[model samples]
Target chain A: MMPMKLEDLLRTKPVFVNVGVRSFGDSLREAGYQVIHVDWSPPAGGDQKMAELLDDLL
Target chain B: MTLKEKINAANEEALRRIVAANPVLVDVAPASEVVPGMRDKLILHSGPPVTWERMCGAQRGAAIGMCLFEGWAKDAASAERMLAQGEIAFEPNHHHATVGPMAGTITKNMWVWVVQNKAFGNRAQCRQVESFQQFGDYSKEALSGLQKWRDIWAPTLRAAVRKMDGVMLKPLIARALQMGDEMHNRVVASSSIFANAIAPILVDCGRSKEDVVATLYYIGNHPFLFLGLAMAAGKAAMDPARGIEASTVVTAMARNGTEFGIQVSGLDGEWFTAPSPRVKGLFLPGWKDADAGADMGDSAITETVGWGGAVIGGAPGILTFTGGTAEEALGFSREMRNISVGRSPDYLIPALNFEGAAVGIDIRKVMQTNTVPVIDTAIAHKEPGHSIIGGGIVRPPLECFKKALTRFGEKYKE
Candidate 1:
């Protein structure tokens, strides 16, 4: 896939991919900024060594 | 510019200074040896200044234990008498450029992690982790554990630190955030990383093999060993941001069992406090929520510099410990941004697509949003003499932020 250009990304409504703290997104919206909330979960059920191993595998 | 605008500009400048801070671990030494004004008779406790008369159960227990540890009293009864008679001077750890976890008691003889904000050339110290005493346990087991740390662990670690000249903590912290540590409730990654960094130094310090082995084993097994170092680092990073006039940024957030307190940059040493909020989440197998102590510790220093509970979304593993779902973690992380002025440049949350963790909590934003800062903390027992009962999430009382806002207006508006 072709990489998205920075200018193109900017030209579109800036979607802030907020990963933690939901209030951040609320604040952004209150400020009229577009925010995309990503539901982040621990990879491999929160095991760091397992996550690292999977990262290597994937 | 309008008065509001001027305040905003000053706050922005203060937050910039905070995010720009570079904290490095310089050495390990006894509290009296490194912490300024940490005299032989002075005892530093966490949260805002509270007298021995007002200290809650765990704090009182910890103080008595410290007196016993220092050989100032022959027994707990004697220690209690000394504390009541004002034989030991009590002060907040903040007054001495130090921070402590949980019951947060620091005596002169205890070893401390010395962290320096290289950018500001300011230093902060924190006591080494002890399972019992810091949590208000003064049992024979607890006292022996403290003795082991003093006699064996601290000296070995100090020698290793000296051999290495100093360990740069920021890089390790940065990496640990990526590996799944928020540097607060979930510090497994940072602890392992720190142990690895210092292992070679320990080997090269020319200590007896047995002592080195025991110290290495202790550090390797103790999951929360790096928590104190992180707290000291956080204190160092936040210290430079304090005392900025008209700046509404929060410089500190700490809780004793009875009260939660916060200091705003503009207000300097003044603390706005309220009743300590109860933690809402999981408890240990035998414990119930009713037994939990109110939020306690100076560990919120991590959130001040934009790690720990601030980056919960990046550390999904924390959910297992804090009894929250992945989505809740994400929400918690996003929520902090509402009250913060900016994101950290160094401490990025990998799960958030490498976005910087929210940094520089602004009291104005907290008040405006009616949002109290969220903290992930371990719950202690309400009464003294019990170790940690469980881990959970907590928020500083809204009254604290409201009072801070009131104080800010009073200080800067006129």
Candidate 2:
């Protein structure tokens, strides 16, 4: 049997949470959907050393 | 103890100090008299420390204007030579426990508002906001405008504040938040409240009648006057939270035209800096983003403590100035909510269903969520010698936050 929740999700509109590029959220909203922009960037802006340090933290 | 536990406990302590803070309008005095280590020949600019050669346009202009105001030089050319020759000393406002907006140029003789955190027993000072000088214009008219502030406006304000014997700021800022003041870019409510509350007291401040009238008019007409107080209050409140070991809570954020910088509670005096970002929003007529400078000001101190863009959801009134619909402004606040540790109980946001204003930005959350603090500030011209070109929104570079978090990890090695 297929997952019941997937069918429910498709039937009702899903809220999109766009992780970066805020304009994606704006575009989604303009296309008649609810969207939340995360205003994200690469972990540590793609700095290998800094990303390693961040990964080491709590 | 686990690293997570250490961060959690330390951040709790920082927020304790922040919420317990009671900043009062304590006094008004010249920078030399009150600013720690302020000297006759010294001028202070905003953000982390930056030197003359790297100085942005507005800041260079403001510094030259200050030199002229101090009578260190009779002409702009002379002042430029003296400043360049190291004949005069300048420093960042943050280094001296003070803050300012825009170019943030303040000098030895300029009068400063002193906000004392009554609970923390520390004081923070900032000078009032005037139009031309902060944007780096040093025309004779602009210089003369500052002269009038030194000669007339400052003295009247000083007398009135002294007579009031310490107006309480927590209530005013809290109330103004309710009245739709963003407490950074648009401070009409707080400025108006301050002027109205002081008008009657100025009657007893003992200046000549004509002087009092002119001073009241100045205060009433200027909407940005209270932006300086919010900066000083933020400084006063956040100072006691400094050096809370293991805390990832940001204690300060600021920008010079060249860079944006921040200090973490655990890091003490060290600043994590990144290149300043351009503002994205409405511009005054005949100007666009090209004419805008890199974001600059010491005013992000307000947002660090949870006001301005941190709670813009409740301040739709500023949307008229910064250009956005109310729901979009609320969306920005919801995004800010993702990075903050929690909401402040004392400062409430009605539009968010009377939720307390989001407070205590946590670096861990910022990194985990990949969100930086949202800033609402005015755009100064990239080159000096111009007035404000526009108002808009901005953010500190993510690189600054990443660098800060990396350093925090190094310092807290298990």
Candidate 3:
């Protein structure tokens, strides 16, 4: 369970890096914590076929 | 080299051409005389090649208006019949080294701003923006405005351009970005800069006081006066990037009210198209979203070369017309950077702490990030005989970029 490490992190303030969905970061900001939000979404608008095609080219 | 490495090399080369381009406003002249291959019976419309039967309502009305302008028909009914019967040849402005906004109808006798990319020695042209007929009003009043351009405005401006030996457009465009002009939907700063440079030349033109007064007054007050010239500059700058093997930079983006299309650098002489999408925009009084037409215009050329929506961070004032918050505008600029090859060396934006404008749309990054380019533009009424109703922001259909990527895979054997 990593009790030692989990207890140590709980003992201090935490800075967060949030990706995609912004609500998570906003919630943290509301709670008076530090958060960095990354504006992102699924590639090719989440079309599986298009995503595969893009991967092939890459 | 491997395919990935080869593609990177080609894209870098294409980006070099895009950033190195020096587009100069060389002249104002008739399309028949300046645009390559323009002919007496031909009318160039916006977007990709479309048949008369498939033409949208606004475009159809503009076609009839142009026919009347060319003296091919005496009335709208007869003009519509001629276009329907295919008696008059129709082609896209992009096919003729030209571009125009909205309905984008350019007849042989129409005057156009000519821009030459001094770096590559290739030129492009675009007709001046009309207040009404461009969006399909063909009333006697609308047609009279065309007569004014034909009879009065064009000749006076042409003389000034010749006397000045051509205006250097790049410096003005660079400065406009700092003054909050995206160079597409809003060009007030560029308009003023153009007027400031040409006012004295028009003064020494030795014309009648009445003539110079009318010309200067119109130029000074018209806010979008520089958009067509900037569009020609975009075309002139981007054309040289086309035909670079393995390059995935988008060379052109246009719409014809019915469909939206794009061209890639490696895929020369080809277009990827999808049905046109509606623009979410703020409308004029008594107008609603239902009254607006589908996205249309050759003005997306500005975004291709990274001037319009790509640099919106520097021009938050456009948000009022295009409908977005200043925060969103700044976000768009940052997002565009992810899709482009790099920032431009010439056009810099203050909002980003003086970073260069985003330059060179790479289709690969578009596929990678699933982000399409944004365009700030004016909106027209959907009906055949109405004029502009509003202004807004629009994006090309994702299908266009997806199809381009699929074709890229096949062409490069990736």
TM-score of each: 0.87, 0.93, 0.95
Which stretches in model 2 have alpha-carbon errors above 4 Å?
A1-52
Across A1-58, the per-residue lDDT of candidate 1 in tens digits comes to 5467976886787778898568888999899988887644454335454344333322
Query: Against the unseen true structure, what C-alpha lDDT does each candidate score?
Result: 0.84, 0.87, 0.89
Question: Total backbone clashes of model 3?
Answer: 0
Once fitted onto the true fold, the runs of candidate 1 whose alpha carbons sit more than 4 angstroms away are A1-58
lDDT at A6 for candidate 3?
89
Task: Give candidate 3 misplaced runs (Cα > 4 Å).
Answer: A1-17, A22-36
Local lDDT at B25 for model 3: 85
TM-score of chain A, all candidates: 0.48, 0.68, 0.71
What's candidate 1's DockQ score? 0.02
Worst 10 residues of 3 chain B by lDDT: B145-154
DockQ (C-alpha) of model 3?
0.62
Q: Taking the tens digit of each residue's C-alpha lDDT, what string does model 3 give over B173-240?
A: 99999999989987989999999999999988877778888889989999889998899999999999
Q: List DockQ, one per candidate, in order.
A: 0.02, 0.40, 0.62
Greater lDDT among 1 and 2 belongs to 2
Ranking of candidates on DockQ, top first: 3, 2, 1
Which one wins by lDDT: 2 or 3? 3
Task: Pick the DockQ winner.
Answer: 3
Provide interface RMSD per model, one decimal: 19.8, 2.5, 1.4
Q: Please give, for residues B263-357, the per-residue lDDT of candidate 1 as tens digits.
A: 98889989899988888888778999888778888888888778877899999888777888888788788889977888888888887889899
Model 2 residue B349 CA deviation in Å:
0.6
